[model samples]
Target: MSSTQKPVSSEDALGQKYDRCLADLLVKSGVGFGAGVVASVILFRRKTWPIALSTGFGAGAAYADCDRSFNPARIPGTRILPKAEAPASK
Candidate 1:
């Protein structure tokens, strides 16, 4: 590494992390759009592209934002801990 090269800071890394999140949002939104279209056609028995597109985009975007904000680590764990067992009587 050259002395002139600067070390990557957390701020710099955050941008790339957000970029990945945005990509994920876009891809998931696309999938949701398709799903919504199919659902509309199946349930409504007609072309409801507008509703489908809006619903899909809204749901996907909301989900992505919420997921990112609330569960950045994506760890599988419960907020509440298990209660300890009581002592057995003789």
Candidate 2:
């Protein structure tokens, strides 16, 4: 049995690269938020309200960073995928 390989077009390759970059940014941001939340809790327990607040701000900043990084403004001229394309199995 012979299997034919389908070549990826430049557009497809670019799309894949963009997707990977966006995904990595999101994952890292999520990790940052999680770590921030944990640290905030720890600081709160230690009676350090200022540190806890700062950690909470860090989480918010991480989320904003993710949004800004993935935003169309940051990646001009690239086609934005529809919401349906978000699922990995799709």
* TM-scores for candidates 1 onward, in order: 0.49, 0.48
Which candidate should be chosen as best, given TM-score against the real structure?
Answer: 1
lDDT of 1 by residue, 3-81 (tens): 6977899887778777777776777777777777777777767667855685668667756675755565654563533
Candidate 2 clashing pairs, residues 3+ apart or interchain: none
Point out where model 2 deviates above 4 Å.
44-90
lDDT of 2 by residue, 1-90 (tens): 999999999898778767866666566656665665676677556445545455556556655655665575655576766898865773
Candidate 1 Cα errors over 4 Å, as ranges: 1-7, 47-90
Query: What is the Cα-based lDDT of residue 76 in candidate 2?
Result: 51
Against the unseen true structure, what C-alpha lDDT does each candidate score? Answer: 0.68, 0.64
Residue 62 shift from truth in candidate 2, angstroms: 12
Query: Root-mean-square deviation of each candidate, in angstroms?
Result: 9.5, 11.8
Cα deviation in Å at residue 69, candidate 1? 7.1
User: In model 1, what is the error at residue 55, expressed in angstroms?
Assistant: 4.7
Lowest lDDT sum, 10 consecutive residues, model 2, at 46-55
Clashes of 2: 0
